[model samples]
Target: MRRRQFLAGGTTLLATAVAGCGHPSVVLDMDEATAADIANQVSISPEPGSAEYTVVSAAIENASSTRRGRSELFDRTDTVRIGDSFYEVSETPLESSEVTVYEVRLDFDPADSTAEIGEIAYEELPAADRQRLDPIISDDNPPSGDGYDVGIGYGTTQEVGDGSVFVPEQQYDIIVHNGDRYRVGVSTRTTTETEYRYEATAVTSGVDSFADRVRDQYLFTLTGLSEAEREVVEEAIDGGYFQDDEAFRSVTNRIREHEGLDVTDSYGTWLLEYEQVEYLTYVEW
Candidate 1:
């Protein structure tokens, strides 16, 4: 339950409490650009105040539904932040067969020219051992049976009578084990057909917005290529995701370049969230 919770009072009240409460601390959207900007301006000095913030990425998708999922960390908190800012920081296993996906965003302030959005796309990867994921041993894997790491995640398969299940259509069936062996599974559909989600319906959005934009550009880039180039593009998309490797790194890299910056870890941030691991704010400076 150590997750983000936004102050209830309207923006006016919350902003005052955070920015004017006799402290130099600022109230920034849960985004990296905002964090970087604040850090540059005033040296983000943490003083036991909360770095956990919310951004309401999508405005009231459904008032009734929002009320329902509001309490839990998963179930779509809508507004989520990474690391201290929207730019999430994380350490990952070299290769994991199991995968989890967390989509988080980083945003910028309109007035701050240096501020820019950061998009994170993580795939809670499984351990590299193919045998651990072997259909024969899936039941033995720690994540198969019981609890999954993420606060909110669902399963497509189930077990009955302590027996391995059979799947005819699939060359292999995923085994269900119990205990701490679970990981967040992204969309079941192939990474090939991607569905695009924007913050607003002609509405509003940001860093996560940039992530979405870049993803769009990549798909468009892949589509725009000629038949010969399309095959390479398809291969690139098939391998992991444009976000997971150099294929799409430049999409966000240019944002940094235009700002006259050298290199960036923005894409790395996205990879972390994909795991669906829970994190609490911890900043040294």
Candidate 2:
């Protein structure tokens, strides 16, 4: 979580944008008090201006090293400026065999707000690739025949917080598997238990809805599973639900929308354990 190098400091907007490489970045106007507090916190620094900024439909968590591994900081809704035209300053999340983390939407103060760039217009890409990115930003939810019914499950099995280096934060992952189609990785957040029952109805509902789309529609999928794994997967699929499509789509789209190169020139490691990986679908209220 503490891995990213907060922009060392800001410069001219042009230089800053170029340095950002088109990824969304925070331009800090934080005074000493705020900067120091944010030193341990992850956040976005904005350029300015956001009179018509829209509140998030969902709660936006700050993407942390554990959540996104610091590499995907760019593609978030860092700052959406709505002055003359709608403009969003977002970074493209890095794609890899590992999880591609979507940067969390940082909260904006009145002074910190910016016009949120709307969805990446899918029409902007080639016809074929456009097909791939299309579903990611569609205003259409599942009930329009593109979405159906599915199954869901969540329960916190543990929590780890100790002086030990092995300790982890809350431990949980939400899995949404469509009936005989592509399954979506809904979440992998800090949890003590292998499973957690989130009290929120969105989670319970989102899980079931996420399952249906995979079964009913032709969403993007990663193939090449072993025969044994494939056999196990066959049983996990389900139909969809109408009410939770938007939230279900969100969990699925972030990963579905990601595909690119991800590598590290340097490296470091501590004690690492491959725990049994579990997946669940959740909608943060």
Candidate 3:
């Protein structure tokens, strides 16, 4: 994400020609050979005011100020050469919020890929709280029962008379089921002096499947890979592996059976890691 420092030299003639022309010149300190190489690559016409010339010229001008490296210009444009590299820009955006913002990431590292949900592990509630919640336990009825609710909640504090009244916030109930954990919660609020309101019942967390895990772990790797290699992983994701348990199991089995595959390539190494991941599941209690 480091900003590349602009180099100073070589385009003195270009700079001189565009000086005092109002807007910032498209010209940078590029040498004649480099400039000529870029011009040829873009196939800019000799006619200065032609459509092709204007578009290429503008793209170069934009790139010189905004993108100065291969990574910076990766998804931006292929016509404008920033440095020595001409990138194969992907039409599909990388599966990351970090990559969306232009000012943040200039380079991507596969090892830095992270899950959106991050780490989920069980945490013990206080003994007293556990004791109180034990009474609500009904193994026959899941947390999705008619009266119970699940999911995140939002509320605000408001002034009542001379004092501020704090509304009941959302609460989470962790349920361990089928070797996985889930978070269920409901929003609570005071309606009046004695009345209360609760809404938004849904399972909010711990729902990732095998394909989801792979997507999170290898997003950057997939982005850097060739179309063929990337397609394998993409198919597993977009093919409903996260929603269908049967499909997820099939993928898991495939990864497990392919344990001996070569790890010489990025995709191969990613598959190896995918095979080793421990998938877990959780549901509302």
All candidates: TM-score: 0.16, 0.14, 0.16
RMSD per prediction, one decimal?
25.6, 28.7, 28.4
Q: Which digits, one per residue and each the tens of the lDDT, describe model 1 over residues 128-215? A: 2222234433333222223332222222222111121111112111222332222222233211212222231221134445344323
Determine which window of 10 residues in candidate 1 has minimal summed lDDT.
276-285
**Top candidate by lDDT:** 3
Which ranges in model 2 have alpha carbons more than 4 Å from their true place?
Answer: 1-76, 79-86, 90-221, 239-285
Which 10-residue window in model 3 sums to the lowest lDDT?
99-108
Model 3 vs. true fold: TM: 0.16
Task: State candidate 1's TM-score.
Answer: 0.16
lDDT of 2 by residue, 141-239 (tens): 432222222212221212111321111221112111221122122223442211111110121123233333222332233244455433323322221
Task: Write model 3 residue lDDT over 184-282, tens digit each, in one string.
Answer: 333343332211111111111222332343335432211234454344444433321122344334443344334311122211212223233321111
C-alpha local distance difference test of each model: 0.24, 0.24, 0.27
* Alpha-carbon lDDT of model 2: 0.24
